[model samples]
Target: MAPVPKSMSGILIDAPGGADVLQWKTDLPVPQLQDGEILVRNEFIGINYIDTYFRTGLYKAPFPLVTGKEAGGVVVASSSPEFKEGDRVGYISDHAYAELTALPAAKAVLLPAGITTEQAAASLLQGLTALTFVREAAGIKQELGVSEGPWTLVHAAAGGTGSQLVQILSVMGAKIIGTAGSPEKCELARKNGAQWVIDSRSEDVAARVKEITSGRGVDVIFDGVGKATFDLDLEIIARKGTLIVFGNASGPVDPVNLLRLSPKNIKLMRPVLLSYIVTKEEWRSYATELFDLIAAEKIKIAVFKTYPLSEVRQAHEDLEGRKSTGKLLLKV
Candidate 1:
């Protein structure tokens, strides 16, 4: 087993702003473990758009902050009986932007057989988010009464979460109409299992959705683009359909008019990951399903790019610029 170091290198943001605030520290103290806590020497760090939000102050952070959400690594020390030295693991936490992270034993999952540290680091957080979005937020079971019965639409369909949504919907045999910014993205969405791809840049989303559904509209719409696509989603979403506004890559949505809900019986929801995966049991269940899908070769994780931990700014720039699709990882 590799020896644990007393100090580690990490990225720190003294205040929220752009990625410019992310500074690499050469001699940061390795976190001390409390009882039932495990310390990991991180090998791979997961870069998520949420990190951008925290950096930009869209999401508040107490600084100086180390703002990463997930990472994969090996346990170097543990005060927890549940783990020991050299256990391969992946963990989720808000303050994860470092070479070493201390996690409560309950918040970490041992990498199962046949799953890589890279896959665990990349998949655990986002994959479970996708599973929950499809199974719960979209309410696929309650909405789709028949096998292969429902039609679903996913905005930003070539995105990290959006692609996973398409894959999960395909597994359930649901017809999927996905929207993307360009033709290349449209093709990527199709490969991820979207039956129809809309170039939102060139196509009228509501008109195309109506044309595809023949005016009945879709059973569910996953709207991650926020204000830019909200009006279109409202107009084209089916009567009694659900619209899950899970993200805001464009910008935060405007105030909604509840009066519209009465006319169409539409349901609007904004589901967040932390609320659903709050409990260890809940975490375990979601992780189990996500891992099963991956282990069984049902969900294929796509990493578009990776950066050494030093280039976190570049990773953030690429993600925030809307320049890439699928997940981005950081080599810690």
Candidate 2:
């Protein structure tokens, strides 16, 4: 067993700004486990666009807070017997930027052998987010209705959550149309199983989408790139199509009318991951299926960059600047 330390280190959010303000702080308590909880010595923390929001003050925290949300590690202490010391585990929980954190045993999923800590860190949050959006928010149930054509559209296709959603939708027999900023990213999207990739920066998204489906828009459109993509997403969905607006990467959109919702009879939603995986059973079920996808080699984790924990500021900068093609990580 690794020697347990009395204190842990983490990135501190002092004020919101560019990556310049992120600070490394030591001496956070090596949290003691409560019943049903375990202490993990985190090895890697996932870098996400949301972390940039928290860092730049686009999203506010309680102040002087730790900044990361997902990590993979080995359990060193457990009050729950179901998990033991040295178990390879990873989770999506608040405060994961720290070198050590107390996590609920139930919420921490044991990683399979051959899955690196970096891959585990890369998968948890984004994978679960994708799972919830497709399986719940869009009502993509297993039964294939006769009216259902296996077609879906995803924006920001090379992004962390977007790529996972693309893979999941493809494995479920959906013909995927993915949009990205560059031709390189468009090709990456194709490698991830997107049947068609449109360079949204150069092409008319609605026109290309129409061409792909022979003037019929996709059955579902997953839009996370907010204001920049929302209008186009709305314009491209077929009548009665489901449009899920789950994140605001390009900032929030202006208010629209209820009448706008009626024109196509579109089911527009703003989904948060917590809303779908609200219970322990739901988390386990979704997480298990996600792991199975990984284990079966059906979905791949794309980590484009990694930095030492102290460079979290730079990591956030890379993510928010749209310089990262896939997932980023902070090695603890």
lDDT of each: 0.86, 0.84
For model 2, state the Cα shift of residue 186 in Å.
Answer: 0.5
lDDT tens per residue, model 1, 216-272: 998899887888888888888899999899887888899987997887899999998
Q: Name the lDDT value of residue 280 in candidate 1.
A: 88
Q: What local lDDT does model 2 show for residue 311? A: 82
Candidate 1 whole-model C-alpha lDDT, 0 to 1: 0.86
What TM-score do all the candidates reach, one by one? 0.96, 0.94
The candidate maximizing lDDT is 1
Candidate 2 lDDT over 116-233, as tens digits, reads 7778899988998988888887767556533243679999999899899888777766778999999899999999988889999999889999998998888899988988887887
Model 2 scores a C-alpha lDDT of: 0.84
56 Cα displacement, candidate 1 (Å): 0.8
Off by over 4 Å in 2: 141-148
